[model samples]
Target: MTQPQRDCVIAGGGPAGMMLGYLLARAGLAVTVVEKHADFFRDFRGDTVHPSTITLLAELGLREKFLALPVTQLCTLDAVVEGERMTLVDFGVLRAPDNFLVLAPQWDFLDFLAQEARTLPGFDLQMDTEAIGLLRAPLDQDAGREDAQGTDSAGDVLGLRVRSAGGDQQIHARLTVAADGRTSALREAAGLRAVESGVPIDVLWFSLPKPSEPPPATLAYVSSAGMVLTIDRGDTYQSGLIIKKGAFPAMQQTGITEFRTRLVAAAPVLAGVADTLTEWEQIKLLTVQINRLLRWHRPGFIAIGDAAHAMSPMFGVGVNYAIQDAVALANAITPQLRQGVVPERTLAGVQARRERPVKVMQAIQGRGHRVIARATVGQRVLSLGAVRLLRLGSPVLRRILARVVGVGLLPEHVRTPPGGSR
Candidate 1:
């Protein structure tokens, strides 16, 4: 069967893929986004939409609509370390209008983008379709040999072979983006190598009913028992219990009641719902990973977000970084895409612009992993130094930390034109 052709074909409908698709479509470039999932409903996905992301939404004039969705604004990041409550990062100091981390389910955010993208004449979204491999045109063919600059090029990628409920099909495009996430099949098929950083901890995520009254803005608890992070989700608290890496299986052998007991002991705040966790099936394991590709692009394709770099969940910046990647990609490629050719240099430029921030953020997350590993092994207590710094250092220190988490090292902005609203 003859495959439909588009200006760009994006694999995976996560933040990176969907946002890039929306931006390209808005720029008047035909784009098709393929998602393996039929719907964007998933438990325990990154729900923290950082200030950086909020800024991008505003740039596209979708801030009000995006904020209309049910979301909780986290203005201050507090934590219970060694039984003492300490304010670590204060988002209130940021000068932006929405100077706080917006906690909304990732699905709502993606759905919002998908709906907005549909308004553009050039946008096409195919749900329940998974990209299986690349559709490569022979390099010898003159039509297939053109580079991003319309010059002769090697390693030309033509499109994607995708599978859906209907069956297998092909999608041809001038450019293909691998934004399918950390375990991207396309990245692997392209033989891009990613350097992995060993993580010493894993997270067990679960949810409990929210307390009738407002909970503390604090999101983390570090005690002799272990480390726990909780985000207030309006009606419930989404929680992550940090356990030693590779220890979950052994911990599971001990039984669910003991696990529940340990959870209550670690964070007394969760005692109310401790008993609600009667079965092990209620918990989901998130195997923490930190890694980045040495190279983020090839002749016909480029990888963004977790496809290029997978971050540790320590700071909940994974989603934020992915969104940033989308913005950078759009800013760099939209003009070329509009011209009907995307140079290999342009693809490499996207990676060059975004790599530094990825490196810096991953280093911070790596240090966090080491700290958590030490606490899990009882090798160290919650650093009183961190508490001292926050206490003695004026609001300046808090603001600095907040800026780091809220906006990241170098944030990207929307550069593409905003299309008509639906």
Candidate 2:
């Protein structure tokens, strides 16, 4: 059986792929997104929704619907540095209305996008479907054909060869996109490799029930013992202890009691419920990484989000950045996709537009990793010099951090018109 060639076939149904699928379908382009996972529900996922993404929801007329889902709005990221508490990031400093960081489960966010996309006639999402390989065909062009025609049958990537419960099938399309995330099978199959930046921290993730009188939900505790990030998830607290890279095995030998003690030392507020972490089964190790591909595109294919750049869990901007990539790609490619084939230059332009922002964020995260690693080495991360600088430039610091964390480096708005082809 032959599948109808679509305007686009995205390899991963993640943040970038789903959003791009939604935007493209809204623009009247046929798109099929395949995800290996049967569902979006997963443990210990990034939960931060930045302010620019919040603005995007409003642009798509999805603000109310997205807000209706369970979410916590964080106006400030409070950090306790060397026993001194200070607000490291102030979302309040950003322009009103869009100001605030939203804490939402990554599953809910992905589900929301999938649901919205399905309503579009051109959108098709397939869960439990994995891209096993790429479909490539040498350019066979006619000189008289236009750019959107045979000219961009272009090179190599024709679509994706995927596998599901029904077995193997081919999704042939004008263009293919790899949004499969870090360790992406599609990216690897494309022979693309990301250049890795060494990260000093690895994180241990677990959740604890809220205490009767739990302290106010903040961002992190940066103490000499180690850094502990606590995310507010309504009734429970999603927390991660930042430890030295490849140190989980040694940390395990010290026993769970020692782990609890160390976590409590970093975040005193968690002292009440820290003892509840009795078994090692409850903890999961997330080896932190920051990496980006030297080339994010091939002839007839392109990569976005973690497929292009794997982000560290620093400011929790990974998901938002991925969505931003989708917006940029959709904005740049929709016109060509509507006509037919998305030209190679257009795909290259999308990568060019997004690469700088990804690099800048990764650099900041790398610096943050170094700063936080000091705590693991028994040194104060927030030295007096830094504290004084922050205090002296308090207003300036708030504005800068708010923009960097909540709004991002280069924010893209939805440009693809809705119901264009629908």
Candidate 3:
């Protein structure tokens, strides 16, 4: 049987793939997005939607509709470092109209995008389709062989070989995009290598019922017990307990009773509901990773978002970065895609445009990891002087921090044409 063809085949239907698919389809390109999961209901995914993303949605004329979904607005980030309460970032001071971050389940956000993309004429999203391998096309029949065996040859990725409920099949496309996230199968199949950094922390995520008198600000408490981050999730408070890398086994051995006590000591806000966690099954472990692919593109394939760079969950920038990548990809290749061809240069252009920001963010996350590791693993108390300095600093300093965390380093705009004919 003949395989189906498209202008672009995007492997993964997360933020990056879905946004890219929407932009391409809006510009009248036939886009097929394949997602391995049957649905987007997975828990513990990043839920912080930054201001940079909101601005892009506004430009696309979907901001109002997007914001209409059930979401909690977080206007500030406060942390209790060494028992000293200090405001770290204030989104209220940002110059942008939508200054605050939105706390909504990732599934709702993806579902909203999927619904919008479905309205377009040429967008096809395939759920339960797992991309297993790359379909490569030879570069030249008589190219000079580089290897001694003369078996190694240059080739371009033509599409993907995917497995679904029906059977395994091939998908042909003018361009193939690997947005399958940190453990990207397409990126691995294309032989792209990611340089990994030693992240000294991992997160244990769980949720508790919302308190009767909820705290006004999202809180990050760093104490002798451990570090804990709690975000208001309307009915429940989503929490992350940061522990030293490879400490989960010891934590498990310590048992749930001791774990609950440690959590309550770290963040007093959870004192009322921490007991709800009776077993290990209630918590999810997120192994933090900070890495980036040295080369984000190979021939006719391009890797974007977490597939290109896996970010640490320090500032909650993963989803925003992914969306930014989608916008960049759309801006760089929509015109070429309209011509029914995506040149290798275009794929390279996307990487060149987005790599610097990834490096900067990774560096910041690395520094943060070191700080947390010292406080948690080394048992050294964080200096209160930095907190005092931030509190005494000018409002401009707070705004700068806000722009860095809330809006990101280099924000991307929506350049692709809104719903229109080719």
Q: Clashes in candidate 2: how many?
A: 0
- Residues 197-259, model 2: lDDT tens digits: 999989999999877797667778887788988889999889999988899999899999999
Give the per-residue lDDT of model 3 (tens digit) for 1-422: 33768889999999999999999998888999999999999899989999899899898888999999988887877787777777778899876688888989999999999999999989999999899888898668665354332223367789989899999989999899999999998777777788999998899999889767877666688866678888778888789999888899999999999999888887887888898999999998999999998788866799999999999998899999999999999999888877778888888788988998999999999998888876556364465676667568736666888989888888999888765545
Task: Identify the leading candidate in terms of TM-score.
Answer: 3
Ranking by lDDT: 2, 3, 1
Model 2: which ten-residue window has the lowest total lDDT? 143-152
Looking at model 3, residue 383 earns an lDDT score of: 59
Query: lDDT of candidate 2?
Result: 0.87
Question: What ordering of candidates by TM-score runs from best to worst?
Answer: 3, 2, 1
Judged by whole-model lDDT over C-alpha atoms, candidate 3 comes out at 0.86
- Backbone clash tally (model 1): 2
Candidate 2 local lDDT, residue 62:
96
Q: Which stretches of candidate 1 lie over 4 Å from their true place?
A: 139-154, 212-214, 383-386, 419-422
Give Cα-based local distance difference scores for all models: 0.85, 0.87, 0.86
Off by over 4 Å in 2: 138-155
lDDT for model 1 comes to: 0.85
**Model 1 lDDT-worst window of ten:** 144-153
- Once fitted onto the true fold, the runs of candidate 3 whose alpha carbons sit more than 4 angstroms away are 139-153, 378-381, 419-422
